[model samples]
Target: MRSYAGQPRPRPLPARYSRQELPKDHLVEAVLVTIFCCMLTGAMALIYSHETRAAIRRGDIDRAFSASRKAYFLILFSLLFGMFVSITWVICVLATLYAQRGP
Candidate 1:
């Protein structure tokens, strides 16, 4: 066995779990969206991300996958909603300015 000078490698997961790729938890994205986007949807995404991490810890593959999917969708929805609102606000502001200019 070869040893590196850096931190030691983590112990291998059980054969059952290690055999296949794990789903993403999306915890970071959830947190970011919660901070910078729609709070309600972002909060929901954060919850789903927590659930995904928990299920992953328990080695419940199906549950983990489901929670990960939910988290991803929530994050996406929050980003889209935020973008929609931002664009709408900008358009309204520009329209107001144009109206005030009395062209």
Candidate 2:
């Protein structure tokens, strides 16, 4: 365990990859998408979130960050698509109601 006099000093790692900090998993957003938005995308988001968590556990920050980004975009897309569908349904329903009222 003695250090050799001829060995070079090891450089420190960057702060971002430190064990104290981890990439975002967006698990909460994934769950919210599952509960309130499209099931398909929500399920996909959940998968990505799980992957992110697993990568972080395995000490693979790059994979974790990639999975986290995927999950985030999936949640965003699911929420937007859900809102569009809901708004379109509401508009159609109101149009039908107004037509039936004949004024």
Candidate 3:
């Protein structure tokens, strides 16, 4: 349709940007790691993960980022601690077996 003289054309609306840089909520991973590793850390991680989603829903970008970082660190710490405990347990078992086999 042609605009008559003095009539202004309608401008197109700007595209809405998405929060693509936000971290993913790893609730399941946190729960699984907590079960296999340390329960407390895992629980904390799960909490943070849930908080991240909640913050996102609430449109609190800073809170979401903070929660996401907390969750990530908790998961990592839990995994590392779990691995350390397992290694120590294995070493103790090996030492016990060797001591028992003394000639």
Best by TM-score: 1
Candidate 1: minimum summed lDDT over ten consecutive residues — where?
7-16
TM-score of 1: 0.82
What digit string (tens of lDDT, one per residue) describes model 2 on residues 1-103? 9877993444344566775666788999999988898999999999999999887766667888899999999999999999999999999999999999995
**Collision pairs in model 3:** none
Q: Rate the local accuracy (lDDT) of all candidates.
A: 0.87, 0.87, 0.85
| Residue pairs in collision within model 2 | none
User: Per-candidate TM vs. native?
Assistant: 0.82, 0.81, 0.80
Question: How do the residues 32-66 of candidate 3 rate in per-residue lDDT, one tens digit apiece?
Answer: 88999999999999999999988777666678789
Off by over 4 Å in 1: 1-14
Q: The CA-based lDDT of model 2 is what? A: 0.87
Give the lDDT of residue 48 in candidate 2.
Answer: 99
